[model samples]
Target: MAKITYIEFTGEEHVLDLEIGTSIMQGAVDNSVQGITADCGGACSCATCHVYVEPEWLNKLGDKSEMEEILLEEVCQPQANSRLSCQLKVSADLDGMIVRLPESQF
Candidate 1:
């Protein structure tokens, strides 16, 4: 399992131990983390699960898919680190990953 940290825009942090292969969105939703709404579940159709991967860990995460890249453009406060949590799968390589939520999902 990977231990991931989710930081809300307000600065609150939720840390969780997520099983391998689970999407980051699923881990947040299952733990009731305050930031991710996951409006489309893990389907990648919604940008509600938008998050900013910490710069230090960005390279560890593979490049975003075309669909993820397109949806990210529509998220609030898109940035160089912006990504859809639904597109990130948990794994040993991602342990200690930290992601910051946008001020708003809309």
Candidate 2:
């Protein structure tokens, strides 16, 4: 299983021990961590699950798909590391990954 770590700006951290095959959004919603709305459910149609993935871990994840890239452009605060969590899947290499939640979603 790959473990993903989520860190809020407030310093709160949630460590999700997810099955290697599940989507990052699914893990967050299943774990009930705040900041992940996943309104579109893992379809990559909504930007509510926007997250800033630490640069160090970016290479670990594959390139962003066209659909996820376009949706990320609509996020309120798009950073160089901004990514739609729904598009990322849990993997053994993603253990200890830290993602920051955006300030606004709606």
lDDT of each: 0.93, 0.88
How many steric clashes does model 1 contain?
A: 0
- What are the runs in model 1 whose C-alpha is more than 4 Å off? none
lDDT: which candidate is best?
A: 1
Clashes of each: 0, 0
Per-residue lDDT value at 69 in model 2: 85
Question: Which residue ranges in model 2 land beyond 4 Å of their true spot?
Answer: none
TM-score of each: 0.97, 0.95
**Per-residue lDDT of candidate 2, residues 56-95 (tens digit):** 9999998999998899889997989999999998888998
Q: How displaced is residue 25 in candidate 2, in Å?
A: 0.7
Q: Report the C-alpha displacement of residue 56, candidate 1, in angstroms.
A: 1.0
